[model samples]
Target: MNAQREKLRMMLTSAIFAAIIGILAQVTIPLPLVPITGQTLAVGLAATILGSKYGALSALLYMLLGAVGVPVFSGMSGGMGIIVGPTGGFIVSFIISAFVIGWYIEATKATVTHAFIANVIGMFINLFMGTAWLKVAASLSWPEAFAAGFLPFLIGGVIKALLSAWLGIEIRKRLASARLLPYSSSKRTA
Candidate 1:
């Protein structure tokens, strides 16, 4: 009974985070190639707060929702067309970023410093994947792709990483204190 409840809780939390990501996706800066969106920050927060399993689940759920034409993506867009679009790599990389961030937090500690490190790493991963995808999808040269996809977002990415680290750590601490979050580590099988 307890295990079932826990599973349900985790799933619910993941769904909530997925919704949160979708909502944040609407907050966009509207860049040329790929608009700057709050999705990455949401992804960082989900990973920092929920840890590896649920964090990845949230990203996957968000992607799946958008892929199914749910308009859960940035600019209220959705469908398989978006998933295969120029910015799709960044969206796809969210799952990898969230999992890596959450796994790092679970393995180490969920402190702001650790979270920032993990978030930075995740940001780089996002930029790299997105840039590569942009190059191929848009048929641009490496320099052009970096200019449009990677370089433009570097400072913003750092800022978002810092914000996600600070806010996420604080929120996670509160959730843990309220007993809403599970263990800090991934050792809790139940």
Candidate 2:
């Protein structure tokens, strides 16, 4: 009964965070190609806190919410149109980023430096996919695509990554102290 309750609690918490990610997407800085948004911070936080499966699930939920016309995506956009828009690659990258970062953190035993590295790598993945998609969708040249899509968000991405890593490390430390993250059993042996 206790375990079931805990599981339920975790699920609820995950769902709330996923919704938070969606809400954060509404707060954005308008730009060409890809707009800067708080969604990446939420993605990093979710991956760090919820582990690979749950983190990915949370991102998936966020995407689903937006696809259903929830106005949960950046600039208050939603529906299938947003999913196939010029910035759609970034949305797709969110799923991959969450999975990779979460898995890397899990594999590295949640070290602070490792978490930071994971997020940095995830950001690059986002950049690559986003820029590539923007190029094709917007009929932009390589330099133009990179300038419009990748360059503008570099600093913001760094800030988000740093903040997420710091927060994630702190959370991990607290959870470890509380015996919530049981190292012996939870350790990924890969």
Per-candidate RMSD, Å? 2.5, 2.9
Q: List the residue pairs that clash in candidate 2.
A: none
**What's the C-alpha lDDT at position 84 in model 2?**
82
- List model 1 lDDT by residue over 134-179, tens digit each: 9999999999999999998999999999999999898888877777
- List the global CA lDDT of all models: 0.91, 0.81
Q: Write the per-residue lDDT of candidate 2 for residues 54-157, one digit (tens) a residue.
A: 67778888888888898889988889888888888888888889888888888786766777888888888888998898888888999999999898989999
Clashes of 1: 0
Regions more than 4 Å wrong, model 2 = 1-7, 175-190
**Using Cα atoms with residue i matched to residue i, what is each candidate's TM-score against the true structure?**
0.96, 0.88
CA shift of 48, model 1, Å = 0.3
Instruction: List runs of model 1 lying over 4 Å from the truth.
Output: 184-190
